[model samples]
Target: MKGEFMSLILTTILHFAATNIDDIFLLLTWFLQRDSKLKSSHIIFGQYLGFIALVILSVIGALGALIIPQEWIG
Candidate 1:
């Protein structure tokens, strides 16, 4: 059971990194800007908020698809 849980976590991390590879570069650039008004806290908060919104929307859409008919989806 423990091994299965660890494998699930590792898979999730790998998939997340693969899909959000661009976000890594984007965050790096934001941090590198020396004179920018954006603080690290602001950047971090915005990223978290954006990710949460994405997950919520994805969940809602998936649930909706399951509730709706296939003919209506097309």
Candidate 2:
């Protein structure tokens, strides 16, 4: 996914990081910490990414939660 920085720039910045999830979080933390130095657009971009991530996670969790046996779901 493209970050506030371009996809190429984001990929390069995370190249040495571990897994994709770790790299994404690392970069996000770095950006949030530098919010004062970043432009409004970038800040918004970061927030959007964070929100989307949360939404996706919530959806996945909801799906998993539905897998519970009906007998135990009472």
Candidate 3:
């Protein structure tokens, strides 16, 4: 049980990092830019909007995967 739990946690972390690595670099670029017009609030709000959209899409995809017949996928 503990081993399974650990594997689940590790897998989740790896998947999350794999997916978000690009987002991390994008966020860093946004933060490092010196443009006076680009406010931190704008960057933060955009990030939140993007994160919410990704989560919503991920949920939909997971639900679809769960509902669909496996043989149909092949």
Q: What TM-scores do the predictions have?
A: 0.72, 0.43, 0.78
True lDDT of residue 24, candidate 2: 69
What's the CA RMSD for each of the models? Answer: 3.3, 14.0, 1.8
| lDDT, residue 62, candidate 2 | 82
Best by lDDT: 1
lDDT of 2 by residue, 1-74 (tens): 44656977767767734435775685677667765677667766876898799879989978877998768756
Point out where model 3 deviates above 4 Å. 34-36
Q: Between 2 and 3, whose TM-score is larger?
A: 3
Off by over 4 Å in 2: 1-37, 70-74
lDDT of 1 by residue, 1-74 (tens): 99999999999999988999999999999888735578888889999999999999999999999999999999
Best by TM-score: 3
**For each predicted model, how many residue pairs clash, with residues at least 3 apart or on different chains?**
0, 0, 0
Candidate 1: residue 14 Cα off by (Å): 3.7
Q: What's the true lDDT of residue 59 in model 3?
A: 100
